[model samples]
Target: MGASLNEIKSKIASTAKTSQITGAMQMVSAAKLQKSENHAKKYQTYASKVKQVTLDLVSHDKGPSKNPMMLKREVKKTGYLVITSDRGLVGGYNANILKSVMSELMKKKNDDAFSVMALGGMGADFFKARDIKVSYELRGLSDQPNFEEVRHIVSEAVKLYQSEEFDELFVCYNHHVNSLTSEVRMEKMLPISFDDVTSTPSLDTFELEPDRDQILDQLLPQYAESLIYGSIVDAKTAEHAAGMTAMQTATDNANSVIHDLTIQFNRARQAAITQEITEIVAGAAAL
Candidate 1:
């Protein structure tokens, strides 16, 4: 009985320790989520303005400009910029994004039809394991990422698109809905779709320095790079949110286990005490 009680006590102690660790992780992830969410929100304003400017440039054009970024060609190869987390314990965050990307890749008739630019260790490693080609990879990003940190990779991706390495590029990530929910989003990033832009009442006029074509030549690539960076920030926010929720769930489960173990310990202790009293009473009667 004592041994059983000791075992139950040990389980209770271990579960309590686990609960503490998970609780701490939950708090840390929540802090990161807040910062990441703020960064994402702030960047969206800049992204919107950039998009508006780019759209205005395209809309004001006299004729179809010969810019490669704005022209669609035969899509012999497709590129995917897949974003995932470097670390685990974020429940299904990485899994969901990776699975969606994999599903899309599986539909391809040949592996040569698509290439990947992985943005996290989890994504890079996943593609490597499956023998999927990862032409560019960036990992170890901070919880709140800055644009400069990702600019090089973004530039490289844009350069590759310009070089016609891939006819189209898509960014795959988890979109943040709320603290408890996120959804997989695969967004097309390249070929500069003019149809998607609804002309805003705000972008009425612009002062062209040289010409609209020259301005587009400079702005289009920067616009594409900004779009990639914005997606990274948004994905990071979703990652942190997922991490916070996962840790919270883990802490709750650990605490529940601790509670159950504590109950078992108490029952064993009570049983031991009752058995001792009954033994003493029987000894007295025998005497």
Candidate 2:
């Protein structure tokens, strides 16, 4: 009985440690999420404005020239920029994004050859294990990422596009819909489409200096950079939210286990005491 009690005590101690770790992790994730949430919101506003302005330029300009990125090409090759967390314990955050990408890949035509640009450690590993060629990789990014942090990957991806390494490009990441919810999004990157702008009844009028082609030549790259960076910011925010939720659940489960173990321990201790009292009373009676 004593040995069993000691074992339970050890288990309780270990579980308490685990609970503390999880609680601390939850707090950390919450703090990160707070910072990232603000960034994500601001980035979304910036991204929308950039898109609107670019669409306005593309729609109003009556030029004989067009940006190459705006032109559609044959889909012989594809580039996938997959964003995931560098660390685990974020519940299904990474898994959900990966699954979404994989599902899309499975639907592609047999002749399409795709390459991946892995933005985090988990994503790189996931693709590598499946024999998917990762042509570019950037990992160990901060939870609150800035545009410069991902500039190199963006540049290289653009270069790949220019070189015709891939006819089309797509970015896959988790979008932070709310604190409790996120949606996996696969966005087309290359050959920027102005369909939404063209369909809209309203368009912004822009006065271009030194011709529209030169201005557009510079604007298109900035627009692409903003899109990629914005997606990364959104994904980071989602990752933090997911981590906080996962850690909170883990902490709750740990508390429940501790409570159950404490109850069993108490019952065992009470039974042992009752047995000891019975034996002592019987000995006195015998004497």
Candidate 3:
């Protein structure tokens, strides 16, 4: 049977409500994304500069070589740092990171030889469901993230790597490029490539406070901290942008469905009235 007028009206009203909610969400996401992108840009400059300086300091073995964060160890067990969104309805935001991690797992010769840690709810659940060894997970990460929040998690991972629990560590996240484009990214964090340091030469002489070892002791941790913070900012921006686009698409689809349903409802109602009027006219003519 075709839908009645009341049914059609109700459907339209429901769709309208949904559109309103989605519209509001899109605006909110856009605003958040804007702020996130700005943060990313500003921090990216600093992060790149930090990485360059790090590479410069470690060159010629001038910096602390024995530090776990700076040590080069044998690749026996792999450690992964996975970042994803805590909530859903963000299109492929969570799935993208999950797939990258899955790809790494699938390609590995010894899945049992590796351990993982998640930075969000989706990643934590995905690894748990698969029975993968997850050392740590931080859920419900906020829009503006701080390194202080995840410092312990990083420390544990670094310590584990030092202790030979994992020889190397990797990270997977979404890299925010623009409002419409976010790319899935997989990055390795551990065994800070001292070799990569030589490739990048420092333009300025980094003056050490008291001495180079003392300065390095403080700088290395800050460098690693900045790396994590920058990644979080990039991932969050991508998440918001993806959600806004996905919601807008859903709203459009709902509008189209309601339009088709209303047309069907109107056509059915018109036919029913026409049939009743024709029968009455025939009866009158017969009389």
Choose the strongest candidate by TM-score: 1
**TM-score per model over all chains:** 0.96, 0.94, 0.87
Per-residue lDDT for 179-277 in model 3, tens only?
888998877766665553436455346554455555556777777667666777888899999988888888888888888878877887898788889
The whole-model lDDT of each prediction reads 0.89, 0.87, 0.78
Q: Of models 1 and 3, which has the larger TM-score?
A: 1
On lDDT, the candidate that comes out on top is 1
Expressed as tens digits, the lDDT of each residue in 1-287 for candidate 1 is: 97898888888888888889999999999999999888888898999889887887777744577788989999999999999999899999999999998999999999899989999999999999988788999989988989888988889889999999899999999999999999999999898887755785343465678887898899999999998898898899999999999999999999888888888888888889999999999999999
Clashes of 3: 0
Q: Write the per-residue lDDT of candidate 2 for residues 1-287, one digit (tens) a residue.
A: 99999999899999999999999999999999999998888887888888877776776644334788778889788889999999999999999999988887787775347888999999999988988778889999998988888999998887788788998889999999877899999999887876655534134353568566777789888898788888899899999999999999999999999999999999999999999999999999999
TM-score of 3: 0.87
Query: Which scores better on lDDT, 1 or 3?
Result: 1
Superposition TM-score, candidate 1 onto the true structure: 0.96
Off-target runs (Cα >4 Å) in candidate 2 are 62-65, 108-112, 198-206
Question: What would you estimate as the lDDT of candidate 1?
Answer: 0.89
Q: For model 1, give the 10-residue run with minimal summed lDDT.
A: 196-205
